[model samples]
Target: MAPRPNIIRIGMLVYPGCLRSGAVMPFDVFHIANTLSGLRVAANRVHFDTCWLSARKEKTLTVGGLSFHPQPADLEALDALMLPGIDHQGPYDLSPLLLGLGPEQEMLRRYAQTGKPIISSCSSTCLVAEAGLLDGRRATTSWWLAAYFRKRFPAVTLDAEQLVVEDGNHVSSGGVTSYLDLALWLVGRFGGDALRQSTAKVLAMDANRSSQAPYIAAAMIQDEGHAVIERARRWLNQRLDRTWNMAELAAHCHTSPRTLLRRFQDAAGMSPTQYAQQLRVERAKALLESTKLSLEDITGRCGYEDVSTFSKVFKRWARITPREYRARFGLRQ
Candidate 1:
């Protein structure tokens, strides 16, 4: 076996509106890994000392209303820092989520200046993006927020399909539960593959679940009360099985295609056709999850006539084959 690394200090940032699970569950995983490492090695080969840190050295409340009193972190001595996700209720309502995070961002900036690895999960990647750490870096977030993230942070390339992406010292993960995956990945990176695999088995988690595509829903694309976008959404929903070109959609919305495109880019953060495809994918997902329809029939119902074309599109949006999606989420009699 390789020589074990020194005791590593991991600081988890806790604050208001952050997901309680994202903040707390990874600690459990780390504890498990630490316990296993202590048992397996002579004289405690690897050690992870984790502590919760607040931005202001005070108690922080989570979105689920849990209060946390944490030790104030010494940012300079930390080996790694973690920024878990915050809570946002409605679709596309991230403006408020990024509020009150300035101090935390400054701390994160200071930590990054130390040239150590910084990890963020789910919506907390927004905070990382806002701090300018993700500028020119490849990152990802919860799949549903890909378009909105792209709109807000244009410099960072957002890959919505990936469950976790690591670029240099910055590591990011997608969705809520993906924090576990991020934790396990960190374990593997620092604690070795054996510890990672063993902890995953003990936790009954499939470490191979590496794509958010399987979990993304079209409804996650919130309208944010944009009149034109909502109208366009309804129009697309009513005719998901029919192919209506952008011209027809523009005509129905009573605007030129150029105007419609501009409004869609402003309101929905994607083009009209992209939104239409999203709706179609959502419809197909419904069929896959709730019906016994064959792939060909479902494809035709979802506006794709060719099976090859439909499968490719479905996999791109859903991140799994239609058959696999059905097997996992389908209603079993």
Candidate 2:
């Protein structure tokens, strides 16, 4: 068994326009874990000592109407550092906002040199990457930002399919809501898996969920476009209800299979076949959410004749069965 600290003091960095949930939820989870510790008879139960911190922006840091007067940039006192998601309206607003995070970036660099734990979730991973902390490190961000992160931080190996990634003392997780996963992970890491389970049961979260694959969406499918790839995408969308081959798709786009493959690999970061699979998964998610169709019917509609095969394909991307997805996210009528 690893040596468990009696109390783990984590400092969550809060910046301007940061996602309030990212800051709030982790605190709530840690607080809840402390409450759960009261119920345990085990000796030396780990305690989480968490506080919100910033680079002293204001007497009170107010973002999205919530206010917090965080602690100072005292890196020596912290056992670990956490960064929560900052709000952004997709790709358009993302870059402009990052340009202003210079102070925050320097903070990461200073703390990173200490070689203690530094955790960043969602768009905060970009700040860490910008600070050059994630270079040659395995990290992840929101799956939608996979292409952008790769192009921007080529030195850092991006694995956007994971809910959380820990390389050395640096820990990173995906997207905005993954703070929940990050918080739960910290609980399990510093405390114990048994406590993590009891806390998760009380919190009503799926403790075993690890991969971000099932939540993958096609929103970023058109990010870096090639003319041939765009044409292929349009053609595929039109016939997603039918199976397709690369040769047929290339012909429709007036390109050879080899040309299409080259251009697609360059533009989409995956094969045309993989992109088509994403489209199918996205389509299946939509149908599952909005329609009450049977599994067999939905399978045929998504171009799979076999329901089992369709389930496998869907699970490959969405991480859950179509029925399970519908049960959780489907419309109630």
Candidate 3:
């Protein structure tokens, strides 16, 4: 395509149930970028004009109960579009919001066909998935809803581990707060790497955050209502400090190893060995966050024989070292 125009027009789509921050944070970032661009020479400046658009012209209430009125705009004329996540407690809470967007799917599909970028953050990726644009494409959403999203849209490849997934003209971000990263990334895409970095520094955002792993809670992986899985989970939780043996664990759960593997995978989306490892890592995280124990002590308590092995495993699961995880949880490094 032709070089991106000097003047970029972006439209933010807002509905009654949209998250207030998600709807306005991008505007703030672009506004900041525009303010910064004013200081540069003409050749180095990038201009962004953003409009908040909604299907209805009347006043709308945000999920947080704040009143908002979005201006009417032409989606076809804009160079790009953004879909902020909706605020909801669970998948069922989103049913009404998703149903409300059913009328706009055709328009959204035509817009996607034009190949103009459509950026979605968190739960709003569901909107694009509903329009079928994400079919056979890699995408992500809030980490807590990964299993639900996968079940809802089997055609899309859902990787909740990613902070952002850019496939063709579709860019998706994970979690609610990732809209900041998404906004900074857009700045890089439109302006340059230097502008992106400067904006991140001004905003105090962690520029190196690329994975959702660090933020995922251990409880999210646990599935309830399966007797075999629950038994295995209880068994593993009680023995996080011990070396895992699949046959022994299977026997303890009162099932054959093959049956145990199949049932565990069906329930937890991972094999028995992987589940035990994650459980141990999660225990390590808990200890790191709550205890004043040294790394060597924590390692031994969490099943690892040495500090080095524990640190490596912890980094693999949490995407940060044990020390970093401790620091993040409010302990001074």
Candidate 4:
């Protein structure tokens, strides 16, 4: 028999006042990855050892109304360390849990110096940024803290719209949902595309699917012609479950279908139908992630009368089959 592949051990640092949502999000993704991959791969081929490295020895600490216990393990054993955001009124007001420069800090710093992968979500970026690990690297955090992050960490380049930014060994993401993106990206990196897709299907999430740049760039044109396109987007968002007609939409916007087509193409770089299809696909993806609805139900909800059509559109938009997508991102049935 062949030797087993080296297992990847991930350490999750749980400190007091940490955001429960952020911490739980990555844990859920990795947990699902382990379950799905472990069935096929040998126990030794793929395994996840999650340890809670905390400064204190308390069995339970309340964070966001939930209690958590720390694991007994040194940080040197982890291949990756995850830092979930904590609630702080300001950057200067550090969490009491992280006040001292003890073994936890030293271990993290050593991992950083050795080029080990570290992922931080939301305000957790501030912790690594303070350690000077993100200097001259591109990163992001919650959009609300973009200005503050930029002001405080002048050495790091801030990209506010990105779901996550990867700079060498350091990676950071914006807001809570971006944690899913980061976890999916990590899954793809460590477990291969099959495992990543399987995890995404379980969560019903679209991994790295859409590019917001085109939408933002078109919105920035700021002309009367662009107003019509903006109105169409708003209109589609509101009527995502209903079938859309170009002539009717044009009439509602007080323009001919030809004029509507011309303006929308110039502004959004896509036809109105194309844009509407994208919205429908996105809606389907959300339903897959947030609900226990069946694929046919999701297809109908996204305005696809035919299941085949919906599956094709979903695959085109997400680069994975709907069933595979759901399996990778959806909750276990």
- Please give the RMSD to the true structure for each candidate, in Å: 3.0, 3.1, 3.2, 10.1
List model 1 lDDT by residue over 99-195, tens digit each. Answer: 6788888888888999988999999999999889999999989877876788789899888789999999999999888989988987888888888
What is each predicted model's overall lDDT from 0 to 1? 0.84, 0.85, 0.82, 0.73
Clashing pairs in 3: none
Report the number of clashing residue pairs per model: 0, 2, 0, 18
By lDDT, the better pick of 1 and 2 is 2
lDDT for model 1, on a 0 to 1 scale? 0.84
Q: Which ten residues in a row have the lowest lDDT in candidate 4?
A: 213-222
After superposition, which runs of candidate 4 have C-alpha atoms over 4 Å from their true positions?
1-6, 41-45, 57-59, 88-107, 209-333
In angstroms, the error of model 2 at 95 is 1.8
Q: Tens digits of per-residue lDDT for model 2 on 109-196?
A: 8888888999899988988888888888899898888877787889999888888999999888987888988898889988789888
By lDDT, the better pick of 2 and 4 is 2
Model number with the top lDDT: 2
Candidate 4 lands at a TM-score of: 0.58
Residue clash pairs of candidate 2 = 214-318, 214-319
Better of 3 and 4 by lDDT: 3
Model 2: residues >4 Å from true position, as ranges?
1-5, 224-226, 331-333
